[model samples]
Target: MKASWRARLAGPGYVILNGIRVINIITFLDIIAASVVMLVKISLTSGFFFFEAVTHAVTAGVSIFLLISELPWLCSYFDRDWPLLGHNSGFITLGIAMFMLGAGVLGNLNRKDMGQDHLGMTFWQIVLSAGVLALVMSTINFVSSFVFADGEKGVTARQIRIYGAVAGQKGEIPRTGSHRTFRLSMKREDTLPIYSPQAGRKSPTDRNSTRFPLKIEKISSPPPNDAASSRYSRDESGIAPPDLAHHPALKGEYI
Candidate 1:
C-alpha cells in the first residue's frame, strides 16, 4: 500500500494536482495581498480613518477573492466562445478598466483643498499617491497573469497530444531539428488541433497516412567470407587476412 501510494504520488497526475494546488494558494495569497494594499491606500488617503479602512478592506478582500476565483472560467469562456477577444486580450482589457476606475474614484474624492493639519497631506496629494500605487500594483498583477497564465507545470495537454502525434511510432521526443520545426509550427493557430470530438475515432491507418512515410530499406547481412565480415576477425594490429587484403575491392585498404 505504501509503495502504491508513493508511486501514485510520483505520477504525472499527482504532479499536476500539486501544481494546481500551489497555483491556487499563490493566487489566494495574491488576492489577500492586493486587498491589504488597497486597504493601506484607502487608510492613507482618508488620514488613517479606521471605519473607512475596515470597510474598504472587507470590500476589496471579497471582490478580489471572487474576481480571482472566477477569472479562469471567464478567460476560458472568452477563449472558447469569443475568438475576437482572446483570453490575453480580455485580461488586458480588464486590467486597464480596473486601473482607470480606481484612478478615477481616487481623483474624484471629496476632501479639503488645503493640506490636513494632522496628516500634513492634502486630499489631492494622497489621491495622487494612491493612484500611482494602484497603477503599479495593477500593472504588476497584469504582467504576472500574462506571463504565468499557463501555470508552472510542464507541457499542456494539447502540447502533449501534438507531441505524441508528431512522434508517432518512435514513442520518443523529436530530434532537435524536428523539435525546432515543431515549435515554429506551433505558432500557427491552425497548425494543431486544440480539441477535437473526433480524435478518439481516428484510426491508426488514418494517422499513419497523414505522417510522412519512413524509408526503411532492407539491411541484408554480409556474406560469411566477405572482407566486411573478416575485418572484425583481423589481428590486433588492424591488418586484414592475406585473402581479404588481396581482394580487388580492398587492395589498398586496411580491411
Candidate 2:
C-alpha cells in the first residue's frame, strides 16, 4: 500500500519533534537541579523563612532559565552572536543570582520583622519582588554575554554579516547549508597552537634524532582533488593549507 504525503513525512517529523521535546525536558531538569542546589546551600533558621526563600529561589531560577534559553534567539534577531548564552554560563549565572536574591529577600523580610507582623508583605509584593529580581539578573547576563564574548577567537565579521543578512530580521538562525561554512570558519579561528621547546628545536635536519618515524598507511584512496581543493589547500609553511587555516582544528599546530 502507498502512503499519503502526510504519512510519508510523519516519521521524520515525529523524530524531530521528539528530539526537541527531549532537549526541553533536559533543560527543565537542569533548572530544577540548580534550584535544589541553591536551596541546599542556604542556612535558614526559621521554617517560614526557609519556605519563603525556597519559593523565591525556585521562581527566580525558572524565570531566569527561560529568559536565558531564549537569549540566543534574541541576540540573533539583533544580528549578534553571543557564545555565553549558548553554553552553561547562562545556567551558572541563573543559579548564582537565584541564591543571592533568595538570601537578600530573606534578610529584608527579617529586618522588617515580617514574622512578628510588624511589616508583612502581601502575596503580590512577593511576586513583584521575584519578577524584579528575575529581570535584574537576566539583564546582567545579557549585558555580560554581549560585552565579554571572545572577539579575537569567537564569531567573525563574515559570520556576523551572514547571520544578519540571512537570519537577523527573521528572529531565527539557520544551522545548515551556507551557515555551516561560516560556523566552521569561526571554529577554526578559535583554535590555538601549543608550543613545545623541544619540538621547536627539532628540524628537518634532525634525521638522526631518536624520534619515532611516522609510518604512512595506504588504507584508502585519497579524496578527489576537486573536493580537497574546495575544502582545504596546502600552504608553503606546511601547516594548514592557506585556504583551510581559518578552520579551528587546522589553526592549531601540534609539535
Candidate 3:
C-alpha cells in the first residue's frame, strides 16, 4: 500500500504540483487568519447587524469559501454541480473580489477607529495587518492560475512535462547543460582539415576542393618595364615587393 502511494507521488511534475497546492493552501490560510481576526473585532464591538460588523462577517464568509476551495477532500463532497465549492476560475475570481471589497471597507473603518484611540494596541491592528497579507496572497494565487491551470482529472493544479520517448523521437529536448556535447562538436570541426586553394590538389575529405599552403616569397627587384612592379615599388625607398612570383595568394608553387 505504501509502495502504491509512493508510485502515485513519484513523477517529474509531482513536486511542482505539490508546491503549487501548498502555496494555494497557505494563501487560503492567510485569508482565514485575517477573517478570524476581523470576526473577533466584530464580536468585541457589536453584533453583525452593525454596518462595520456586517462587512467583517461578509469577509469572513468569503475567507471560509476561499479556504474550502483549496481543500480538495472537503470540496469533493459538494463539487459535483456546485461551481463555487471547488477550484474553479469563476469561483476564485468572485471570492477574491468579495473578500477584497469587504477587507477594504473594514480596513478603512479600522483606520478611522484608530484615529479616535489613545493607545494603538487593538484587534484592528492585527486585523489590518492580516488583511493586507491575505490580499497579497490572494492576488498571487489569482495571477498564478493563468500559468498553472487545473488538471483534466479535476485536480486543482498540474504542470506540463515532456516524456523521454517524445524528446528522443522529436529531438526537441533543450540541450541546456550539455557542455560536453558542445565541446565534442567543436572538436570535430577543429579536426576537419583547413581549406586550401592549390589547383589540381584536393582537400583531405573532398576531391573537388583544392588545397594550398601560404608563403610570402621575398623578391630582390622587379624589371623596369613591368608596370605592376612600378606600382608595387611606388614607395620612395625602392624596396621590391615582399611577394613576387610564388605568393600564396596567387596559388603559385615555389620556383
Which candidate number has the best lDDT? 3
Model 2 lDDT tens row, 1-255: 222432333334334433433443444444444344335444466677677666747655654555545444455433335443343222334435544554544454444334334333443244335434444554544443333322323422223322322212333333333467787788762353333453544444453444554334533554467755655454455565445456667655741
lDDT (Cα, tens digit) per residue for candidate 3, span 68-108: 65555565454455544433322356337545644674455
- Model 1, runs deviating above 4 Å: 1-70, 74-76, 80-91, 110-133, 145-255
Segments of candidate 3 deviating more than 4 angstroms: 1-17, 23-33, 39-49, 84-106, 114-125, 150-255
1 against 3, candidate with superior lDDT: 3
RMSD (CA, Å), each prediction:
20.7, 26.4, 17.2
lDDT: worst 10-residue window of model 2: 158-167
lDDT of 2 at 56: 45
What tens digits encode model 1's per-residue C-alpha lDDT throughout 29-87? 44345445445444345564787667556645544643443343465665566532342
TM-score of each: 0.25, 0.24, 0.41
Q: Cα deviation in Å at residue 41, candidate 3?
A: 4.0
Error of 1 at 196 (Å): 34
- TM for candidate 1 is 0.25
Q: Which structure among the candidates has the greatest TM-score?
A: 3
Question: For model 3, what is the alpha-carbon lDDT of residue 34?
Answer: 53
Deviation in Å, model 2, residue 121 alpha carbon: 5.9
lDDT of all predictions: 0.44, 0.43, 0.48
